[model samples]
Target: MVLEEAYVDNQHNNLENVAHEMDGLLQFNTDRMIFFRNGMQSALETPLDFMILRKAEQEYISKRHEAIWSVALHNRRTLPVYGVSDAFIDKDPTLSRDNTLSGNELMATLELGYLLRLTNNNRGFTERMLYVSRSGFFVSTESANKHHPGAGAL
Candidate 1:
C-alpha cells in the first residue's frame, strides 16, 4: 500500500532525530533494511508496511546526507571517496560547465555518487530491487536474505 500522509508527515517532522538515531545503527553495522525498519518503528507509533518503511528509509538517507558525509570524512582510514561526477563531466559535454548546472541537480548528482560509493562493490552481491504490484512497491526481504545472509535479519 502507498504510505499514509500522516506517516510521511511524522517522518518529515522527525528527520533530524531519526538521522541521529541512525548513527547508532550504523555503528553496529546494522543492515540497511533493518536500520530503516527499526528507524521507522522508533519514529512512529504505528507500524508501517515494508514498502512504506523502505521509502521512509530512502527519505532518511537523503535527509541525512550531511551526517553520512561527516562520518565518511572523519574516517580517514576508510576507502577514498571517489570523484564520481568527474567521470560524467568528461563523458557528457553539456555537464562540463559548472555554471550551467542548477544547485539541485549538482546536489542530487553528488548524492547519487555518495550512494554508489556507500554501497558494497563485491561482485557476487545481489542488490535490492523494488517490485511494484497491485498491492504496492514490494521488496522480498526473504529472498534478499537468502542471497545475502543476515541481510534483512534484525
Candidate 2:
C-alpha cells in the first residue's frame, strides 16, 4: 500500500526504505522460522527435507550478512539489482526520454549499491538478522561443538 503510494505520488525519497520495511516485516520475515524449525525437528523422524528447504532460506540471510572480506577479492561479484518498475516522472516530458531513463537507472544503481554495501558485510544486523541456529538448520551450535569439542578448529 505505502509502496504503491510512493510510486503513484512520485515520491521516490526513502522508497527503498519503504520496500525494506515491508520486506522486513512481512514477505521475508523470519521471526518464527527457527522456532518452527526447532519444533519440526522435535516432531518428525525424517526432517532432512524440511531442513534442506529451511537451509536455503537461511542461506539467503546468512550469506547476505557474511563479511565481504575484500569486495575485490571475490571473483564473482554480486550484480547490481534494478528494482524500479517504471519512470518516476510518469512521462511528464520536462526531461527527455533518454534523460529520464538515465535518471531512473542512476537512482536504481544508487539505491541497490547502498543496500548491497550495507547488507553484504553486516553481521548481526538487526534490520535483516538471521535467527537460525548458530550451526545452521540442523542442530544448535552447542550440540555441534559437543560432537567435536570445537567445531571449526585445527
Candidate 3:
C-alpha cells in the first residue's frame, strides 16, 4: 500500500528510522511474515494489505486518527488496502472521498475478523531485522545465511 503524502514525524525526523521502527514492531519469525518497503514512497508496495495515513496539517489529530481507525476496522479485505494522500500538511479535499470509497470496497470484499486478526496480532511472532524486497516483503540476511551459508557472498 502506498502511503501517499507521508512525512517524517518531528520526533523521528528520518524516514529510514521510521521504517526500522516499523520493522521492529511488525516482523515475525514464527509465521515468516514481514512488512517491507523502502520508505514512504515505496511503502505503497508492502504486502500487508492496508495503508494508514498520517494526520494532515489542517485536520484535527484526534478526528483523523479516529477516522482512520474506523476505516480500517469497518473495511476488511483479503486483498491489501492502501491509504493515499497528496501531501503531509495541506488541504487535500480528495482524501476523504478516496478513503470512503476504498473503505467501502474493502468492507464489501473482506471479513471484519480477518482484518482484525492481521492488525491485532501483528506482534504475535518473533522479530527479525530484515531487508525489503522488490516484491514488498521482508527478507532476513541472517535467515538466508542459515539456509545457504555461501549465499551471503553472492
Candidate 4:
C-alpha cells in the first residue's frame, strides 16, 4: 500500500525523484542486480528444479558444518569432492559467447580434497580456513611446507 502510494506520488511528480533513486541503486550494485536477475530468471524457468537443487546444496553445506574432524590424528587430509562443475570463462565477452553459452554443463569430474588444520588443541575445531577456487574447488597445500631460517624441524 505504501509502495503504491509512493508510485502514485512519483507519477504525479513526473517520477524524476524516483528515477534518480533507481539510478542510484543500479549504479551502486550493478553486479548484484545481474545476479538477482539471473536468479529470478532461473527460478521462473524451473521453480521446482531450482528449489530442489538449492535444498540439496543447503543440506550438503549443513552436513559439512556439522561434521567433526579430529585435528589431533588428521593434521591435514584431502577430502574428495564429487560432481564438481568445471568451466572456464573467457576474458573476452564476444569470444566467450561465440564459443560457449554462459552456465554450461561441467565437462569433467575430479576428486579434490580440502586441507584442514587444527589451529587450537581443543575438542571443538575453530579458526579453520581453506583456499578454494571461484567454482568451489579446494586447493590443498599440505605436502608443500614453507621453510624459514631458525625454524626447528617439525
Colliding pairs, model 1:
none
**By lDDT, highest first, what's the ranking?**
1, 2, 4, 3
lDDT of 2 by residue, 1-154 (tens): 9989978767665676798798877644464455445444543543224343344334333333332100111212222221111242233344322432443333333223333343445443344322121121111112223434443331
lDDT tens readout by residue for model 3, 1-154: 2344343344456866889878876554423433221222232344334332222112322333331111222333222222222232125432333443443433332332233334444565334333322211122313234534453431
- Assess every candidate by TM-score: 0.20, 0.20, 0.20, 0.19
lDDT of 4 by residue, 16-120 (tens): 877889998777577545644664565456433344334434433443322221111121322222212222323323222222421121111011222132212
lDDT score for residue 153 of model 3: 32
Please state every model's RMSD to the true fold in angstroms: 20.7, 23.7, 22.4, 20.1
Query: Candidate 4 local accuracy as lDDT?
Result: 0.34
- Which whole-number lDDT from 0 to 100 does residue 6 have in model 2? 71
Q: Which stretches of candidate 1 lie over 4 Å from their true place?
A: 1-95, 98-102, 121-154
In Å, residue 63's CA in model 4 sits off its true spot by 4.7
Clashes of each: 0, 0, 4, 1
- The prediction achieving the highest lDDT against the true structure is 1
Q: What are the lDDT scores of the predictions, listed in order?
A: 0.36, 0.34, 0.33, 0.34
The C-alpha stretches of model 3 lying farther than 4 A from their native spots are 1-30, 34-90, 93-96, 99-103, 106-113, 118-154
